[model samples]
Every structure is written in structure tokens, then in C-alpha cells.
Target: MSLALDLAPSASVEVRNVDLAYTRKARGTAPLSRFAVQADGAALASVPDEMEVRSSHLVRFSPTGKPATLQTYSVETLRKVEISTSGDTFIGSTDDDLYVFKDNKKSRFLSDRRANYTDIALSESGSRFGTVFCDMLAAHHTVALGDQTGRTLWTKDLPFAASAVAVSRDGSVIAVGGEDGDLWLLDNARNTVLKHRQEAAMEAVAVAGTNRVVFASGGGAGVINAEGQLLWFTEIVGETVALGTDSVARTVAVLARTDTNAGRLILLSGENGLPVWEIDYEDSRPTGLSVSANGEFVGVSLRDGTVCVYKLFYGDRLAAADGEAVLAEARAARSGDGSLLQAVALLQARLGSVPSDFRACDLLKETLTDAKEQALALSANAEEIGDFLSA
Candidate 1:
């Protein structure tokens, strides 16, 4: 006897595989000391030169996984090491010193009285950097901004302890999130712009563009505008481990752990905190997460002493098909129908992955111009405008 099985439509939908572009093993068993992505999409990682000593060596890897430069540091522990887009490096260490390494020279910039710096953030241009200091003895935390030369620009004391800090790409805004659920947005002049209270202690914080800030806490993650308004919040299944953002693309990548201790990466829109996609990894625990400047790639460092890079546009094959369908629907509809505008947006999103679509770009430009003209005409008509406003 033979049996027949029925399958759902979703089963027939092609499942695109995400490419594990590259993997590099850490130097020793201690895992990666720290890792950051450069502005040009290169990755920098630090690993112990020796298994028993506190000394470490920093390694630079190209986007294609080729090892580039390697530098040795005598510092004991490099807590928060960040590299600017321009190849400048800023690092805070257990020795209570902040150092700036540029042009093959290392200079000690600031000596903190605190135990160690909890986090460090660098501006896109590497002109400015910010750090969060954890002074356990004084029972207070401080957020300090500094220039490229490692000179302290300004410092702000917080009532609660902060572990996460971030500066906007333009170096115009600074954000600090504390363990006591305090969130502060400050201007470059050290003036407070907005302050809010979060439900849980913050684990990560990032600035997206000029007006949006994203943060992850024990409860989950959320996004806020520059005006201090809560845009949206999403609850995760477990601990929020790390957060990374692409300011240019307005995309946020979050690393969290499931209840079973599996690692998962979630991508969200920076504007609305809406979920875009997610990937799960059961074999390794994520220690660090970073997205490229253009949001085209994501790199994850695992506790097993391996770094993995994945492409963001691997699912574009499916998206292009959906875009074609939307365009067909728009063409079949009436000229003034809203489907045309929807088609334009769909095409725009697909263009992120398929930038060579000249036909779609031309159609989008024309549709946007038509929509703008229609809007202007409606506003010029008094009766039509009044009716639209009332509705």
C-alpha cells in the first residue's frame, strides 16, 4: 500500500541559505579578547599572545578573511578596544589607562581613577570617542568624551553605574545606559538633551543616524528617537548579549541567548524597532557582534574561539521575486491607485541588494514624482483638501 502526503505552499517556497563567509580561530583558548569592525568592513580582533600571560596581540582581517596586520601590546587586559573607520585605534585597559594608537605610534590619552572602562564607542570618522567608567569604590560611574588625540573633551557623572555608551556618527550626540535603568542623551557640549528610565539594566547601546538610538537590556531591546519618545520595544527569550547597528542603513543587529543557552541574532529596523529577520546558532555562544558600516555583513565572535561572518543580502533572491510581483500588481491597477507607491517602496528595498536594477530605479523615480504631483494637486483643491483632512 502506498500513502500520499499533502504539503503546504510554504514548503515549496525556496529556502535561501546564509553564507558562512569566513571563520577564524582565536589564538588561544581564552577566546577573543575583543573584536571590532572597521569603517571599510575589515575586522580587528585581539587574542592572548600566550595562554598564561595577560599580554595580547591584535590582528586585522580583511573582509575576505585574509589576515593583514598584527600588533603586540604589553597591556595586561584590553577591556574595550575600538577601531575607527580611518584605522585609528582606541583602547582602555585594566591598567587604568586609555591609549590611542595611530600612525604606528601609541600614546596614553587618559588615566582613569576607576577600576576599568566598561565600554568604548568611536565616532564614524574617528574624530571623537566616548567611554564609560566603572568606579566601584566611589559608587559612581562617569561617561567621558574625548578627541582624536586622546584628550578628554568632557565628562559627566551619573548616579547609577553605566556599562554601555555610544556616540552618533556625526559626533553630535552621545548616549549612556546604566545598570540602574537610567538612560541619558547628551550633546557634544555635555548638555543633557533627553533622559529616560528603562525597565532593566542595559547591556548594549548604539546610535543610529542623527535621530535614533537603540538599546538592549535584560528585559529585551527598544528604540527611541532624539526627542526621547519610545518608538518600540521587543521582548527576547533570554539575555540580551550584544547590539550592533549600521547608521547609514538604519539597521540594528542584536545578539541574544535562548533559554537553552543557544545563540541567536535578530535584525531590526532602526526607525520602528520592527523585526526584519533572525538566525539561530546552536553550536557556539556569541561573545561579540558587529555589523558593517553599510549593513551588508555581520560578524560574530563565538566563545569557542571562532569568528564567523555572514552576508546580509543572502535572501535577496526571494525579495527580488516579491518585488517583481508587486510591480506587476501596480501595473495592473489604475494610475492613481496607491499600489504604485507601494511598488516604489518595494523596489527601493530590493535595490539595497540588487543595486544594478536600472529599470526599477527609473520607475521608482517616476512614480515618486507622480505621487508628489498628485499630493500637491489635492492640497491645492480646497474642497478635496477639507474632505481629506476630515477623514
Candidate 2:
């Protein structure tokens, strides 16, 4: 099962889906076999019930080369879809309206709200779903399966005109970005409002981790905690964009326009409004930005039909410095010098590395080794600095 591309009469195909569909042509006889080319793309063992040829065009594809409404044929159309890290497929749907083919059956994770559903997002573990409904007005809901014969978990009324919805990897947090320029974070387990903002109209939103939310709205991007504290904010120039978040480390990656030219990926620290890293997409705008469950890599899908992957590492500069100080203390202790502790104190105060670096083993040893001398020196120097600090 490899991806097959249509040969434009006689042209080399650069990239195409390794599926059982392709366009081909021949001289006088009927067109050549469209499935002649051996496949080489995202593997698909069996076609799903709903197969839309055009992007965003939902269509149910029959094994015999027919397309229908996804919800029409109950047996085949309702298919559960799951994407594995190694490119394996899983089948299962939640309790909502949009059903998926999973476990050889049709399942749904959304409510059958008569309102038009605009967006849906599945949790990283496929245990929950977040959906947006636009009726006379718009609102959002996050649903999870309960531990009963057939029970479901739903959040309280989230009456925001949501543009997008995202759930955390652990399914602890659900975020909805409103088209009306408001963002709401919900605690799915407890059905509580963790945080919300009405400043920017959200264009895109993604759960960074368990407690962090990343949203792109108005002309800027910002991150907020489960408690709704504004961690950081920055500007990006794009009308339509995508966001990815890392909850554990509280980081965000924004795929937005760069210099009014092209789209780029900017990784920001959720703690401070500072950029950790960025990647350029040249003249292309991103359709999606996905961060892996492990938070090690991010995948950006561009409008030009290209997907790029980037590796990311969280940098704890203050923590590293603190670790160095602890090591110095340990070394001092091993050397039987008592002055090491005083040296550490002075270093920590001067460098402001006190609470951040708690794992200062070697530093502790060094501090212990010089403890006696340091204590004497401190006693003398304290008189000068103590009054200065006190004053």
C-alpha cells in the first residue's frame, strides 16, 4: 500500500497520497490503470467511510468508488478515526454527533445539536472531545465518556461563539477560542472555569499542556494559565493562523504571518512573553501546528500542501545556574571547607539564583568544605551589607 500519483500524461510526480485513487490518461484506449503506481505516503490499509476528495469537503467513500454523506450510511459512514505516532490507525468515536469508524463500528463523541457544528478537536489520548456549535448564537462543549454502561461527561454551558476548541494531552483542560474575541479555559474534570479573556478575538487556539493555553487573536498571540493569569503575549501578522501548546512545560508555538509575507512558527515561553525558537515557512501560511504528546517535536502543515517537522527543547536557564551552585556547595562539603556555604550565599544573592536552582549538590559540598571560614567572613561583612540592605 503506497501512495499513487497521477502522471500528467508523462510527468514525474513529486508527492501524492499513496492511496487507491489517482488520475491517469492514455492515447486512444481507455485511460491506463490509475492504481498502477506503487504507493508511498501515509499508509491507509482500508479506506474510511467518509472520504472527501477536496479539503474540508466531507464525503463518505465506498469501497466500490462511491462517495456519500458521512452520516447517511450508518454502518459504513460512521467511522472512528485515530492517528498513531508511528502512523497506525485506530477506530473509535466519542458520544458526540460527528461519529468515527473505530473498533469496526460507528461511534460519536459529540452531541446531535441541531445547530451547525463548526469545529471539533479530539484529545491527544482520544479520551475526550471539544466541539463548537453555532446556532442562533454560538457555544462550546467538552465531552468525555463516563464509567457507566452508557454515560457521558459534559462541561457546563460554555456560551462563547467559539472559533476553535482544543483539549490537553491528559484531557484535564479544554479550551475554546471565541470568534467574538474571547477565550475560555474549562476544567473538564470539575466543570469549572479555569480562566478566560475578552481582549483579542481568537483566530486559533490549542492546549499547550495540562494547565497552559495558547491562543492567537486580534493581532497578537498570548498564553494563559488554568487560573487565567496572562503568562505572556506577542504580536503576529496573519488573519488566519494555527497554534500549538505544551501544557506541562507551559510553552506555546504560534504559526502566524511573518513580516506580512509568509508564515512562520514561533515557540514562546509560557512563563515569560519571550521567544524560545522560531521556524520560517517563507511565503506559505500554515493550516495547522501540532505538538507531539511528548512535547519534543512540532509539526506544521502549510497551505501549500507541505508539512514540516521541528524539534523543540525547553530551556531552563535559571534552573541550570542553580544546579551549578548546588554542585559547588557539594564540592566544598567534600573538601571539609566550611566557607563554601558563604560563597554560595554570596553567589546566589549577587546572581539572583536562589530559589530557582535547588539541586545544588556539588555546590553544597563546596559550601560545607569552607563553612567555618565563610561563617567568619560573613560575620564581618554582614555589618556593612546588613545595614545597607536594611536601610
Candidate 3:
């Protein structure tokens, strides 16, 4: 795939304190794959019982990669739940009302009414939050910034349904994107910092720690800094349904559904929006994504009621079957064979990926060695094809 960046990339940008969940070892000739679908996750402090798990639609992770408890907040069936960045304040929305749990008190912010809240976001300090509200009685939509006490600080009517909203770490800037394909950056005083539009509906939007904002949709994803400059934009291959952003590491994790309901998860660098790592899924499309622990681990929710977590960096546990299958197929190909051309193409694709594993490099070396062995063993009646190619 071809990718273009609006600004020139820096010399180098590495994620801070990246960790690998899996590991690979060279015990023998058969090395393991670099990627894998882990069934288990980090240690759990406490979680909802069976009944609560069934009703819950979203999952959150703490800074230590453990499941975050709502603390004193009572949990049950909830449409959405959001906690303040400081981890003290908790707010959740049900089918009819909104609740805020703080200071050992749970208060109802919104009474039982005909209004519906689709999305809610909290600032880092828990001092304020941003939300998108839709009125069921009529076709009216509004986005507002509210204090911890449920007081509206600022509000605006949107041309489209505001599907996603985010507040910067400092609570001075708010980023809101709507289904009308518009993304706007607003100050705390309701001043527009940046205005952007795309061909597809904007579903996933976030405000980075550097005061930069990111927005993604079926059309593509892009980053705009606080100065209203487009840092980078790239057209993705599939419909980006959901995404996760890491403010500390400055990374964006996109979950896209490709052909045949297959899922493609790509992690992009926040500096230039370039892909840092990627993996694919089969049959099930992931609908939810969460990045935690400074981008060390990524957790995704699939349509098949399954949740998988993966580490961002290199490790020792070898379980990526698809990658191993491709390499094994390439190893079986010899010179002058029809599959030789196809094998080279596959190997190049693997190598093209930004970070490659040691097994892939070793396979390339073995392929050339196997080709030479086959060529030397040619029959007397067989015509020589010349020297074996090596790089």
C-alpha cells in the first residue's frame, strides 16, 4: 500500500516504554512466529460477575494493564462508561439517565427523560467532560462540555450527529467529530482551532497529549496539531470502524473491517501517522479498541464475543500461524519453479512491513540455499539455468 504524509517525518520517533507480551526463542531450527492471538490477559484485580459481564458492552484497562474497576461506582447494564484521567471520578450513562460517582457518592446528573446520550468523554483532571446528546422527541443534536457537577460550560448545535468527542489532557482544548464527516477542534471558550472534513463518517476521534487531534473513518485517518496544521493523513484500505489512541506514546490503533468481515488492526505513529505495526484477523470484525499502559498493550473486542490483547513490541512467544504458514510455503519453493516468483513476492511483502522478525530473515537465507542445492542437483540432461541469485 502507498502512504503519503503531509509533513516531512522526523529523524526517528519511538514509543516510550514499549513492552512485548509474547516472546520468541531459538531453541532449535523451528522458531516461533512473531504474532499470536492470546487467549488470556493481564492479572485481574476484580471484575463483574457473569450477569454483569453479559450486560456490559465496553471494557477498560488500567495503567498497569489490569481491568479497571469503576471503584465505588455500581455497575450493571450500561450504554457507556467513562472515567476521569486521574482515576478518581467516574461517570456512566444508561438507557435513560447519567450518573457520576465521586467522593463516595453517586449522583444522578440527568433525570429520566426522552433525551439520549450517545457519547461521553472526561478530561484528564476530572474537572470537565464532553458529550454528544440526541433528543428522541425530535431530530436535534448537540455537543457540550460539562463540569464534574454536570454544569454545562459550553455547548453548540452540530450539523450532524456528533458520534465522538475528546478533551485534551490539559482540558483547554476539545476535539469533536460528527457523522456529517466534519471534525472540529474547539477551545475551552468555544473558539474553533481547526476545521476538517472527510469523505466518510468520522467515528473515532481523540486529542493527543501534545494538543494534537486525530480523526478517522471509513475514508481514512489524519492528525492535526493545535496550531491548525495537518500533520499527516493517509487513506486506509478498509472501513475503519473503531480506534484506540495513546497520548503518552503518541500512537493510534485502528481496527478496520476488510473483505469478508476480516479485521485489520494497524498501529500508526502519532508523529507522521505512519504504520508502526499491523496484524490481521479472520471472520470476525473487531468493533471495540482500547490502548493502555503507554501503548504497551492493545486490547480489542471482536464481534464473536471474544477479546484479544497483544503487545506492541518484539517478544519470544511465537504463535502467529498465518505468518508462519507464509514463511513455510516460501521455504518449499525452489529455482525455475512456478512458485518461486510467488514466494519472492510474499517474502518481499513480509519484509516490507516496518518491523520484521528474525525467522523471516532466516527464511530468505534458507530459500537461496535451497535453490542452490536444487540447481547443483540438476540432471545431466537438464539444461543449466545459470548462477543462483543472492542478495
Candidate 4:
């Protein structure tokens, strides 16, 4: 699990299910909501009176959105933060600089020649790091490779600014996703190995193996071999909202329309790009998604600042056993003549595994909307799942 990458912007977290499927163990909004931004540069929330404009730091929030104890830094706004697999070193980025934290000491520098860093990545070994620099005046984007001590290794200009970047486990390969819908594979020396182009931007890229690359885009998810041939492509209808942060068992990705919150979380084999299973989570607008390296957990963060995590169960019979188990529990809950509160608790339990059936998702929505006619809106049911959707 040496690979780490960043997702698009949105508010914080809520749910804290650590069961056998998707699991963020929580998600809560950060006191510093500037991390959640609109692509159009709209206002989100104001900074606290005690915090200074230059006093930048990364705050850890429990799934409930309350601040947890963590270290702090001075890179204003702290755009994106990633740590090595060892969890000893960390890399944080800003619009113009990159910060490296190790051994309880920190160092900062403007990486490479370009500025306006939009995205950041760190290798699993914590030996290497990279940045996506956007030169707005020149109308182009650049990628920079560097070492852990705040040193720039090399910079490669891109046809367009990159939307995301990922580093391989061994720290030898780098994947860059461009706004122009191109995926570039670069070696340690910055040589281009493969360039896969598409009509949509790449939301994420992973080094599945030596020439095996996994990518998620607006169209769908797929894999390619060293020769750059399309190994397999799963056609998705709209934009890819988030991708599972899978470095070992690359198994899941999220898809949804840009204009709506309806989304599909697809678990694929990662071998042939065939669908293993899919779940519908209309819980909230998914801003981020990823599966644990062991393939046992999946996490989805919604736009309302709620982070929902699920623990997964595996099976050889991928067709129905996995999904059937979910619906079975839902049915059992209803057959027991369970109260709506119990259903909401079960709803929180199956947050990400609500079956591929849209009816279950519709039920959550319809039940939440009936708040006008019933007290359910202000009940724990709302606090459970309804709270996120209201945002």
C-alpha cells in the first residue's frame, strides 16, 4: 500500500462504520473548511478568529467532524496531504510550495521551476514525491519529480494541467492524469513510457504492475498493457466522481453524472475490468472514494462533509452472494417489524452496500423527504443518513 493520491474538493465526514465493507471509520467537517472548495471559487466558510491567515495547519477530524489531535504546519490552506506507507514521513502542498515532514522536523520549498501547485503525490517508501504545477499565465500545467529532502529532481511540461498524479510502490514509476484527458506513464528519469488519450479527463491512475496501469475517467474504468492497448473498458455514463485509493488490490471506482448526486460504486476484478458488483449510494454527493489495500474496506466521502466507510465481505461467487447478503439483511430488518429507527441504523450499517438496486436508495431518499409529514427528519434516522443529504 505504498501509493497515495488526492481527490477533488468537497466538505468533510460523518459516518464511522468499520464493519466488513466500505470504511472511513468516519468523516467530519474540518474546522478549516477552506479545504473544501467549489471549482468556481465560491465561498465555503470563514476562518476561526483565533487562526491567522498565515497560520496554516492540517487538523485531523473524527468521523463526527470534531478536531482530533495531530501535528500542524504553516503552508497556508494545506491544499493536499499525503504520507508514505511507513507513516513516518508526510508531504503537504500549497499553491507555490511543498512541505516534507519527517523525524518530527519539517522543511518547505518551491518545488521545481514552476509554481501554483494544484496536486501532490508521495511514494510508498517515502523516498520520492511529485507535484502538479499550473502556470495560469502561460495556460499550461507541469509535473515535477523530487526527493524527500525538498529537492527537485526533474520537471516535465504537459499539454494541459494534470488533474491527478500517483506514484508506484517501488518509487520508480509515476502516473499523471491531464485535464486534456491524457494519461502519461513516466519513469524515474522522466522518460515517457506510454501516453493513453481519451475524450475525458482522468480522475485517477494506478500502477497495477510493470506495464499494467489502471485509470478512471468520465467514460468508465479500464486497464492497459505495456504496449498501451486497451485491455478492457467498462463504459460509464457520466463523469467519474472518485476512485478507490487501491494500491494492492485495485478493485473499485465511483461513477456519476456531473449534475446529480446519483452514483454507482463498482467493484471490478482488476484483472479483466469485468464487473464484480455494483452498489448505488444516493446518500450524498460523493466527493471521494477508495478501497483499503487489503480489499476489505471501502470509503466514500460526501460533499456535505460526511465520510462513510464500509467493511467488505469477499466470495468466489461474485455474481450474487455478495449483493444478496446485503439485500437479505435489509429484508430481514423489515420482516422483524423493525422501527424506522432500526432501519436507519441498518441503513448506516449498509451505507455503501445498499445493493445495486435503485429501490433501496430511493427508499432512503423518500423516507428522508417525508420529514414534512413525520418527525423522522429530526430523529436519529435523519442524524444517521438524512443529515448528509440535507446538505
Candidate 5:
């Protein structure tokens, strides 16, 4: 069988001659004869999933916007819950078998009757994987894959059936959105729920950068900080079906589904949850929409098998530069350099006296602690500043 996908205006991705028998071919052997991909009429590499090609062949675009390797898995069909990145791949068969693919080699992660994996997600660095599975009573269990051994390093019990799982780019937290309309945050080290919110019928959830998580809920949408404080919310005419954030632009993108229109995409000012732009798709339904952390690219896939990739241009150099300056200042302050202490002090003072119109205001507390630690160390009064930060 073959499938051709129009991914962009002038570009297309195709896979062809995929085998129907799901068998594990020998490593370093002939690449699966059943699969192939072509981009813009140029032949792209294709690697079919083990034997029967029961799994979907993922054509992941790297962080740099270039097409990377193709990932395939062993299962009954594309429905076998698999996700991959440039570096790693996770696959779960319908029969509750779990497997991991790395460096073109495949191995079983779990092979027990209790190993029913429901959802799998990879961190941005592709260094870790998170999976949600079910026990005898259909309860949910989550497992975290260690980068070095491909083994389950952390596991925890969940309260509800998990629909989606995501790991932060920095691997500090794992967020789970479940069927019970609740979102749970798990600290990766202890595998414990750090926060939970049960108010919204959440369809999707994602962690943006290091500080916040955004979710698409039935009421509209929500943004919550690391402390689980509801940072912002926006009213919507439809159910928010998808949510994504771009760290570069400090913005969130939401896709809503309504009774009348197929769907619409809304861009919100991340700092305050204000709607900035909206685009509606009157005819086609979006199968998936992904946004880069930097907000540089937004990729939307339609049910008709077409994907649209949009590059957002801030187009405002002054404001864009100003945001970048603040981020740089924060980084410098944390580096224990006296030169940045004055700049940090200026930013903190600006935060104290100014109204809360900017995201910088919320960032001031961290800036003060980071800057003071650096300055006090040089003054011989450095007691680690833990009390100050905690207070």
C-alpha cells in the first residue's frame, strides 16, 4: 500500500510499497522494501515499521525545520499508539506490548499482560519517554523511560484514564491530561503529582518552556504557571480542541471546534491570555496541529491529508527585541556576574513600581533571588540565600 501527503504549498511527503506482514527485519539488513517517501518530487528515505508495517511511519521534522529519519513500529495498524522524534521512538501494540526503537534497533520495553500502554510521548530532547498504561481494573499507570538504559526508571499510579502525556523540554515535569477532564503534573524525579485541576473538560495539554502549562478546555482555554496558579483564561464560542505554546514568541495557539464551523485557530497573547488573531477553517477538520516552542512554525494537518505549515513573523522588531533583552538579562543575572547585578536591580525596581502589564513582572522574584545570590557571594555574606528565596 501507499500514501501520499501534501505537507505544504509546494511540498509533498509520500510513502509507498509498505509491507503488510509485521516482521522484525534483521538490523543492518536491506531497509524494508515496502516503504518510500518523496518530498517535493525528490526521493526521501523511507524505513517501514517491523515486517507487516502495521504502524504509522512518522516523518518528524527536526527542531531546525528539516525532515529527519523515518520511524516505524510493529503493531496492527497506525492505531497502535506510537510517537517518535529524531533520536528515539516509542511504540505500544494493541495487545499491550511495549517496545522502544533507537539507533535503528528495536527492543521490548515491557512484555507483560499488565503492560497495556495507552499513550506515549517523548521529550523535546528525545532523551526521555513517558507512557500511560492500564492495570487489571482499567486504572492508569505511568512509566518514565530512562535515556541511558531504555528501562522504566520511574513509575506512578494515576487517578484516571490518561488520554495524553507530555514531558517538558528540560525533563523537569511530566503533564498528563486524562479522560476525567483533569490535568495532573508529575515531578519526574519522584513520579508524584505536583498539581491537579479537575474543573475543565480538557481535550489537550502541553508544557510551554520551563515555567508554564497551557490546556484546551471545554470552557475556553487556560494557562497555569509551575505553581499551578491559573495564570489566564479566555472565553470561546467553541470547545478548545487543541493548545500549544511557542516559547520564542511567548504566545499560545488554540484550535476550537464548534457545531457550525469545522474548527478555528486562535493566537493568544501568552503573557495575558488575550486573543490576538483568529483564523477559521470552514470546510476541513484539523487532524493535528503542532507549534514549535519558539513560536517560529505552526503545522496544521487536515483530515483530507494535507498539512499546512505557517511561519509566524512578529514583524515588530522593537517589541521582539525588547522581549529578547529581558530574557538575556534574566540569564545573565543567574550567572553570578556583578556586571548584570545593576541591570537586574533595574529590572526588579521596574517590576516593583510598574503595573502588571508585562510578563516580566511575574519573573521579577526569580530575578532578585538569582541576582542577590551572585552579588552576596562576593560580599562574604553568602549563606546560599536559600532563606531569602524560600521567603
Candidate 6:
């Protein structure tokens, strides 16, 4: 079967055999789908508690859709999780420990105080990660940064209990938001660079690029620069559920409830915090929100465990048309001429528009090697012809 999607004005692309499914009540917090698109244009999603027993699973799908399991990791009490831009590295926190999964190995790090982690964020490169920890007994909170091996680099104490934490794309800066309506910007050395006060309690925080950080508090959201100056602020109806930002795209995605208690996802410009687009859903509340690094897609995960991905267009007609044409050629050539180059290109293009499609990439790599060998043989024949002519 084929599906034609109108992603932007005057542009439509046909996707083949694409299907999506969701597992209900996957976890308390919404899951994150790393890059929205893998290197080969496949989409990847991380759903927590997919198999029960506090286990989380990584799933891969395509624009011409088929969903498949990529990997599964089990923990004692999974709390917060973040996936790297490449979708290969995973950082998560449990009730008392932090975990990092990379290269098919799992590493666990213990906290100094055995606190419950409330939120976690990772840099785009996945080399650094940060977490917000709450000390229930001490009635204090802490923000800690760690490397890929799960070693804590630095930890900063917060005056109020922190509700969310985020790190910049390059891991050079960190943003922490507290339940007491305070936002703090810190450097990599864990020193407070700037702080701002809001009107309501902070629910989420996300860092975009190097100079901007966005946070949601109660029913309101605001953007601030690294200098602590408020860039803009906007208020929405009902409670704010989640916030996400694409540092490369400089766009922010906010999830909130309506007056009637319906869920709505709003896309805003990170530069000035202006609304770009908004979508409403009648069934479930959004538990998580994410935007692709290129601002090409936004993903929303609902309370019922449904993860929906939408394509965003910034007016590249040539790229869109080329992607569509290559996808069509790849689909047709799948059982015909076997053009590995076209397939590889199609996969790469598809990833820019969708989430993960690792299976397609894996399958096409073998064909790519064969194609390379055939080209080498043809080059050898050409060289022989040249030598014969010379003789």
C-alpha cells in the first residue's frame, strides 16, 4: 500500500507500506525518539516499560512504514531517559542510579545521596548528559553532569527542587528549572552563569543551540538567552505538559492541555518564541515532546503510549521532490534492477523527513558493497583496455 502525505505547501510525497502502532501505558514519562531520523532516514523511538518490569525498548520505523524492535534494556526503576542524536547512545536515570547504554553495553552509576532523579537531558553528541535529582529527606535538589562512562563531572545544588534539566547541543551549557518558578543557566564547570524568576512553577526546560533556553511553567512558557534576559513569553490555556527544542532548527515544541482538557502541541520559533503551528488531540494528553535537529519533524508521545510523528517543511522544493522521486525509485527497484545507490540515497533522504529506518540501511549496505565491487571490476577492465591500446 502507498500513502501520499502533504507535508508542506504544494508538495506531496508517496510512502509505501508504512504502518505505526502504540503500546498503552508505556511509562510514567513520555518516551523520546532520538533524532527523529537516523543517518539512513529511518525513525527511532524509545518506549519505556514496553515489556513490563521497568524495561524500555527502542523501536525503528520508516516513512513507508514498518515498525521493528531494535533493542531492549531492563532496569530496576527507570525514571527519565534521553537518546543521543545518532540514536546509538541512551542515558536514563532510575530512582537511585543513572545508566548509560552505548555500543551494546550498559553502565550504571550510583548517586552520592541516593536521590530520585526527576529529569534528564543529553547533549547532541551524546558524550555528555545531565540529570535533576531531588533529595526527599533533605528537601533539596541537585543538577549533575556526567560523561559517557557514567562518571559525574560536576553537581550543583539548587535552592528549590528542580523539576527539569537540559544541556546545550555542545554540552557547554546547562539549564535547570525549579518548581519554585526559578531558572538557572550554568556553565560546564557547574557555575551559575545566570538566573531568572518566572511567575509560575517550572514544569520543563530545554536548551536550544548555545544562546537560547526555553522553559514551561504551569500554563506559561518563556525563552531566555544565555545572558539571562527574557526574550519572550507566552501563556496558553490549561497546564503545560512538556517542552522540547531543536537546537539546529532553533524551534521549540510545547505540549499543553486545553480548557476542555484536551492535548495540544504547539510549535514556536526559538528566536522570539512566536507560535508557528499548533495541533489538538481529543483523546490523550501528551507525555513527551521532541523536535528533529533540522526542524524537519516533531514527535509527540501521549499518555496512552501513542507516539505520533509529523513532518515539518521549511520550503525546500527541490529536496522534497528529489526525496519523493528517490523513494519511489527505491520501492520499485526493491524487486527489480537493484540499484543500491538509489536505495541508499532514498534512505538518507527519508531519515531527514521521518524518524529511524535502520533495517533498510542495514539491508542496503550489503548491496552497496556489491555495487562497489562491480564498479571496481569495470575500472580494472578500462585500465586493461588502456594498456592494450598503449602496447
Error of 1 at 385 (Å): 71
What is the TM-score of each predicted model, taking all chains together?
0.69, 0.53, 0.67, 0.62, 0.60, 0.68
Better of 1 and 5 by TM-score: 1
lDDT of 5 by residue, 1-391 (tens): 0111111112121111111111111221211100011111111122344445444454543323445446554444333332332334444335465566666566666543466666655565556667677775675455545552467776777767777676676566777887777687777675555575756556777776446777766567777766666766777767665566654226677777765438777776666565545667777665455565555555554444444555554532124355557656766655655455665665665444322214554466666666587677766654446556778
Report the lDDT of model 2 for residue 17: 9
Expressed as tens digits, the lDDT of each residue in 1-391 for candidate 3 is: 2244455334244432234453211111110001111123331111234444433212233334444444433555555556554445656677566776566566766454456787777665668777778888538888778778766687788777777877765677777888877888888888788787766778778777545677886567877765656667767778876666765436677778886678787777665665656678887666556565355667665555455566665333223465677687776653444465567667766655524444665677776676566667775225343333321
Give the backbone clash total of model 1.
Answer: 0
Residue-wise lDDT of candidate 2 within 1-391, one digit each (tens)? 1111211112111111012222111111111010101112111112222354211212222223433323222332322232222221122232234554333344443344444555556554445555565553433433332211112475355555667776665556767777677776666664557657656677877776555666777677776665676665676655646666543544456777664547776665455544545556677555555555545555554445444445443332443344455566545644567444555565455334322222342354445556667678889898989999999
Q: Show model 1 residue runs off by greater than 4 Å.
A: 1-18, 28-35, 38-41, 50-55, 112-116, 134-136, 259-261, 314-391
* 66-146: candidate 4 lDDT, tens digit per residue: 444344444455655665544456777767777887765788756335567777777756788877777747587888888
Worst 10 residues of 3 by lDDT: 27-36
- Residue 314's lDDT within candidate 1 is 31
Candidate 3 matches the true fold with a TM-score of 0.67
RMSD of each: 16.5, 19.1, 10.1, 12.9, 20.7, 17.9
| Model 5 lDDT, full chain set | 0.53
Highest-scoring model, TM-score: 1
Rank by TM-score, descending? Answer: 1, 6, 3, 4, 5, 2
Ranking by lDDT: 6, 1, 3, 4, 5, 2
Misplaced by over 4 Å in model 4 are: 1-70, 111-114, 159-161, 248-250, 255-264, 280-283, 317-391
Better of 3 and 6 by lDDT: 6
